[model samples]
Target: MTALSIYQQHDRLLVAVDCIIFGFDGQQLKALLIKRSFEPEINKWSLMGGFVQQDESVDAAAVRVLQQLTGLENIYMEQLGCYGEVDRDPAGRVVSIPYFALIKIDEHEEELLEKFNAKWYALDKVPKLIFDHNRMMNQAIERLQLKASTQPIGFELLPEKFTLTQLQNLYEAIFESSFDKRNFTRKINSLGILQKLDEKEKVSSRKGAFYYLFDRDKYNKLQHEIKKFI
Candidate 1:
């Protein structure tokens, strides 16, 4: 058989991309979910997703899906994995590549969310999702926890400047566990990748916590010296 003839022998499968977007709301980690508009499971909660277009790469498709719902670009996203179980999607023979994204909760465009009938649910409180999305979410959470421990990626979900208390809160939200305030602060201080400012966040207390910015330059240099953040 000719190479072209041999290539035509196999069955065709659809390729799709799903985005598992995580955000921090100062207390808990949340994921953005949309009400599916198409049938097979119309109106059901699902991860933001779409079929990969003929002209676009999987990465571009994921970015388009995320931006359609969040109205933001230049997001911090990473591929979680691929799901190709035969019956994972009752709709058809579709393979989905899921990407996990971290976004600052306060920065997303509210109008875009309203347009898509989307909602943000705390990770622990997320409702059952369509198809194998729950499985994808569980895996994304595991991957995020691993990434957060080894890299300073968590800063992507926080404001440009935040208090130590807020920083600890973000870590606790990601890990779903509490840390000793003093110890957490000490550990973060020891890293020397934070630039402390005179400005303080007084809304939380009478004696407010000073704000600090993540020093990306310092973090880049510190990466070679240290292996983990928590």
Candidate 2:
């Protein structure tokens, strides 16, 4: 049989990409969710997703879905896993590739979120999601925790300039555990990837905390080295 003839005998399947967009507001880890607009499970909370087009790769489809919902581009993203269970989707036989992205919450477009009726839900308090989305989200969170342990990927969720306290809070929220302030500060300082700025953030207290910026160049140079901070 020819290439086209052999492929024609196989069944056609619908492929899709689902995104678990994570954000850190300096206090809590949040996931962006949307209430389903159309049927099968109408009006239920779901991750942002879309059908993959014939011309686009899976990564491209994920980026497109994220951009459509958040109005942001080139954010940090990674493939979580594939969900191909036979009865995962009620509407049809669909194979979904799940992706997780970390974005600065303050940088996303508020208008797009409002347009899509999407809201940020704290990781610990997210509602029941439709289909296998809950499993996808749980797995995504696990992957994020693992990624953060080895790399400074968590910085993607924070602002360009932030206090060390904000960074510690983000890690605590992600791991859902408390870290001793002194130990956490010392561990972060040992990383040597943060540049202490002369400016101080006076909003929180009379004795303001010094602002620090993540040095991307230094981090890049040390990318091959394994660094762990918990």
Candidate 3:
């Protein structure tokens, strides 16, 4: 065997990137899904992803796919995990690098998602995914929960100025349970990440609750503190 062929065969691997795109409309959390147009999973609903080209970096490949699907850049995304089970991908032996990205519904490049033939579905209403993509999404959700526990990444899915009720809704969705109103407010207030505004939102209540804005820069610079409410 040729020396190069031997080495290449010994180390050959398939690299793929899966994007878990998260979005939040005014009420519910959503995700962008693309109808698979490739072999092995044609027509299936899948995350925006692709095999990494020989000349591209993992991050570069993810950006390209995200851009092609969302038409936006500089969104919040981090490496979620790796899925390397021998049969994770049915097409062949492949390892996938997963990333979870967050974009506010108002900020999502709707035109781009449309042109790419992608649709946004609520997180709870997401359709079945191809291969191990569902596992990738679960891992991404865990990553988001961890960060949300200590950081202000939750704000990435919220509006610039939102109501306390809206903030609670985001938290409740992540926690997957209803929270006591008094305790929830107290705990969130203790974090000092929000700046209450003078305006009020009349959509959900008649009393018109005041609006608030999360201070992301300050929240990030602050130390990680765990504060839970019943």
Candidate 4:
């Protein structure tokens, strides 16, 4: 047989992409879960996912899944890993690549979420999911924690301009622990990746905390030499 015929001789397995979507709502880290529309496990909580099309790459499939479910594009996403256990999917022999995405909580389209029966659950309170999705969620959280410490990726979950308190709250939510205010502030300032503005957020206090913007340009310049966030 020809080379093309030889490759086609093997059994075919399906491939799918699942997204563990993460967001921050000022106080806690949240995950977006949808009620599965169809399957052996219909109406069950699951991560947003779809089968990879023949014409598209896995990365493209992931982006398509997120945009279709959330109606938001240009998101911050990273591949977590692949899961290819013999029976991970009950319906078929399918290999799944899971990706973790960070999105601003308020930026997602509300109508799309409602259409998909999607809801944001605090990471600590996420209910049991269908298939191996619960395992996917746990792995995504672990990856986010590691990424947060070594990189400034947590900012992707926050608003464009945020107070230091808001910034700390996000980190605390990700790590599921509290941080000392003085130490956190000192470390943040030393990075020199933030631009402090004269504007202040007065909602939480009379004195008000100043707002700061993450300077991507500055961070890009200093990324090689920057210290761990925690």
Candidate 5:
């Protein structure tokens, strides 16, 4: 192929991933966002991501983008969806493949998350995002709600040792609705994932609620068994 033909086949269509990093800080659901460092909306709040390279897969590119922006190498990430609107990115003709992650936020390099000026915005109250990012955020929130209920995946946002109250709070935040404390505890206890700890957290309640750990190994085993049984 000649230079002109190569140029035509270059496929210059810009490809990028927008990461919606969600975390639980023991109280509510939060999302990781960064200030854009490059134009066309330099310094504006946006999801952390970058262009895909010729040698990498979409998942690989998303991981690289997350690491570059937040310094987090391994975290729970899922391909939310693709936002391919022609005018989604103002900088150029680009198709932004959106991805989302749910982590403990305390699990990764905190210094980098802060050094990059990546701020954690409460899911209940988020800032105005750029371009089609608002739509992405909305979809992510819906996904979280659905995933939290049907699948035993909410543990990703909490510490290994979590309290029943903490579990309830996470559900409340995701659902944006109040739940009966007694019923919530009773229901979660039935799941058989929580491992009771002797320790108690008195930071909030004067009575001090007991701390419990969400055993992932057990949950995963049960999950697999469930599929086989079904």
Candidate 6:
């Protein structure tokens, strides 16, 4: 029998990938969500997702879904986990692979987002998501927290240059707690992965805070090194 024929006796189920796109807009941590356009839960808030095609891997499918909604490519994404409860999807038996992506909020294309009815919702203010998405989001957040503590992945959410306050705010938003200013600054300085620029961000205040950029060279060299920020 052919390979396809050999699996004829086995059950066939749809495989889907759901993306939890996280963004930090200087002040708050947000998630990209879309209002479902098709049944079985039309008009409800949901994570952007699509069924995997025969020719594509789940990773490719996840990237496609993220690109379709945000018109972005080469984003920082990671597979959160798999959700395979037999009846998780009401329309059919769909096994879902969830991914969490960190993106700069200001970098997404507005037109593409509008096309998908996509909007950024603060983590605390997000509406009830369809399917097992709420669970998926919670898991993603936990994973993000763990990853941010050890990795510099959180830098993906900020702009190319940011102030120390903005960086501190991003962490506070992620962990839902405030940090002591002195200690937080000291910890970040200890990493030595940021390059302080002469220019300042004047938008937040008249005096403005000096801008700092992530030193990719230093970061790459220190990838194996772990530092605790939380």
Q: Write the per-residue lDDT of candidate 2 for residues 1-230, one digit (tens) a residue.
A: 89999999999999999999999987999999999999989999999999999999999999999999999999999998799998999889999999999999999999999999999999989999999999999999999999999888989998999998999999999899999999999988887789999999999999999999999899888777745656
Which number leads on lDDT?
4
Candidate 4 regions exceeding 4 Å error are: none
lDDT of 4 by residue, 122-144 (tens): 98899999889999999999999
TM-score of each: 0.98, 0.98, 0.87, 0.98, 0.88, 0.96
Model 3, 1-230: lDDT tens digits are 89988888775679999899987776677778888887888989988888999999999989888877877888788987688999887788999999999887777677877776799888788889999888888888888888887667788888789987888898878767788988889888887777888898987788899999887666666545534322
Q: What Cα-based lDDT does every candidate model obtain? A: 0.94, 0.94, 0.82, 0.95, 0.81, 0.93
Taking all chains together, the TM-score of candidate 3 against the true structure is 0.87
Give the clashing residue pairs of candidate 5, or none: none
* Preferred candidate (lDDT higher): 2 or 3: 2
Candidate 3 Cα errors over 4 Å, as ranges: 1-6, 9-11, 224-230
When 3 and 5 are scored with lDDT, the better candidate is: 3
Question: 155 in model 6: Cα distance from truth in Å?
Answer: 0.6
List where candidate 1 sits over 4 angstroms from the true fold: none
Task: In angstroms, give how far residue 113 of model 4 lies from its true place.
Answer: 0.5
